[model samples]
Structures are given as C-alpha cells and as structure tokens.
Target: MMQINSNPILAFLVTLIFISIPLSALAAKHNNATEKLSLNQDDIHGLWIEKRKKKLAVWIEDCGNALCGRIYWMKKPLDKKGQPKLDPHNPDTKLRNRPRCGMKILSGFVKNKENHWQEGKIYNPNNGSTYSSKIELSKSGILKVRGFIGLSLFGKTLKWERPEQKLQHCG
Candidate 1:
C-alpha cells in the first residue's frame, strides 16, 4: 500500500491560488496605468491655443506607427486682403507650405515615464520648421510643450491651454 500526504497537495493548491490573486491584481493595475497613459483621439479632441492668442484646434489621431496631431481649425484664416496667405519667414519650408487649416503640426509622441511623453515632433507655422518635441501633462491640466532643434539645450517651450469646446471648425 502506498501512503500519500494529502497535506502537501492541499498546501500547494492554496499557495498557488494565493499567489495568483495578487499577481492578477498587479497585472490589472499595470494594464489600467497603461490605458491611462495612452493618447486617445478623444482625449485631445479640443481647441488648444498658444498663450491664449493664436487659437489652433488639435485633433489627436493616429499617424501610421504612432499618434499625431493635426490643426483642424484656426482663428485667423487670412490676412487683411483675404488672400491665400503664406508664412514667408518660416524657417521650415515644409511647415510654411501648410495651410492655416488641416496642417499636421505634431507627431510621434510616445508614452514615456509617468504622464510624460517623448520622442515626438512639433511643427512651427511661424518658422515653418519641425523640431523634436516633448509634451507633459501636469496635474493642473496644463500641457507643457517643448521643441528643440539640435539638442535639449537649444529649444523653446510653450504652454498650451486646453479649450472649452468639444468640436471646432475654421472660419
């Protein structure tokens, strides 16, 4: 006759179940954090203005590999003459060619760290140039946007305020 220790089997089962519970909870918490950090199209669907002067509506949609932002609406469409205008002094010709509306101004923002995004690109309409950009969302609902040329030492930072409207159209 073979004698088996039932205590060992029961103890193993309890240990396994106990270990799985916390592991599953940890996994769920991790997944929730990832979901929160993800930049969804609806999360950025609003009008964001630069210094409360130049109003530009930003639409957060996917670009092929990552996420991108497009200018869907603008406050000023044309100059005094109402002609198809151009940003002549813009440093980047690519950005200069972009019209007031439907211009892709931001791209490639990957989630990094906690509530901080890096590895992004931002286009400046004033200079018509693209620079390495980074965006961070503060607890106060302020977006800190920084754009640099060569290195982080040489860059400009801009704080954009979130707009109120859900949908905005160019006038």
Candidate 2:
C-alpha cells in the first residue's frame, strides 16, 4: 500500500505566502515615493544641468499645454571635424543625422498636480531610448526627474539644477 504525505509541501507553501505578503507591502511603499509633487510652469522652466554631466544642459520651456526640454548646450558642442555633434544613436535613420543640440529630449509632460508633471517621455540620445517620465521640484530647487520602463519603482531618478548662466533661447 502507498500513502501520500502532503504536510511538508503544505507547510512550505504557507511559508511562501506569509513571506510574500510582507514583500508585496514593501513594494507598494516604494512606489508611493514616486507620487506627484507640487510644481508649476515657472518652477520647471529655464535651463537645467543634467546630473550625470554638468557640461550638458537642457532647456525647459512651456509649450502651450505641456512642458518640453531640449539639449541646449554641451561641453563639447563640436566633434573633431569641427561640426556640431549629431544624434548618431537615434533609432530613426532620418533623425540620426540631426544635430544633438536643440533636440527636444523631453516631451508631452503635463501638469498632474500643483508640483508634479506626469505622462511624459524622456529621450536618452546616447542609448536612443525613450522612457515614461515624471518631474517634481524639490524644496531645495532641485528638479527630481524620474524615468521608468514598466513601473515607477523600476526607474531612476536624476537631479537637475538650474544653470547659473542663462542661455539665449528657451521660449
């Protein structure tokens, strides 16, 4: 006669369920940190220095219903051939030859709260990828820009600061 013993498997499954409950709760808490902030057009406007490189700057402007940002300046504006650097990494062949400067890297960001812009996309010219994005102005005047692929939890946050020296354009 053969007998079945399910006690060990049942105990293990129960342990997994208990462990997952806490893990799920932790994930929810982490996502809440990405919630909207209190911000306005004026706070987000002007040139901002990319955290990764201070020499690179983005000009943020008000575009009727939404806000947009473009690559306004770069430490090395020109290549060895004395020509403006181009978006060589762009996925679109037609756009690949376009100048990196003045290219709008940020788009479709609409104000979601008094301090947060949501439903936006941020383009990384280097990698030629665009991700879902949001923007928030911190109390210290730093812009907290978050870009994600699937969920806000699975994204990165970059701090952008207003340039001390203003550029000629951003209107």
In terms of lDDT, the poorest run of 10 residues in model 2 is: 33-42
Model 1 C-alpha lDDT per residue in residues 47-157, reported as the tens digit of each score:
466655655666666677766887776777676888544566576556555456777778998877665778999987776678998887676556777899878779988
Q: Which residue pairs overlap in candidate 1's backbone?
A: 90-127, 91-127, 92-128
Query: Which candidate leads the pack in TM-score?
Result: 2
lDDT (Cα, tens digit) per residue for candidate 2, span 29-82: 776533222222246887788765776788889877999999888887888998
| Candidate 1 worst ten-residue window by lDDT | 37-46
TM-score (C-alpha) between model 1 and the true structure: 0.62
State each model's CA lDDT, in order.
0.69, 0.81
| Model 1 Cα shift for residue 100 (angstroms) | 2.3
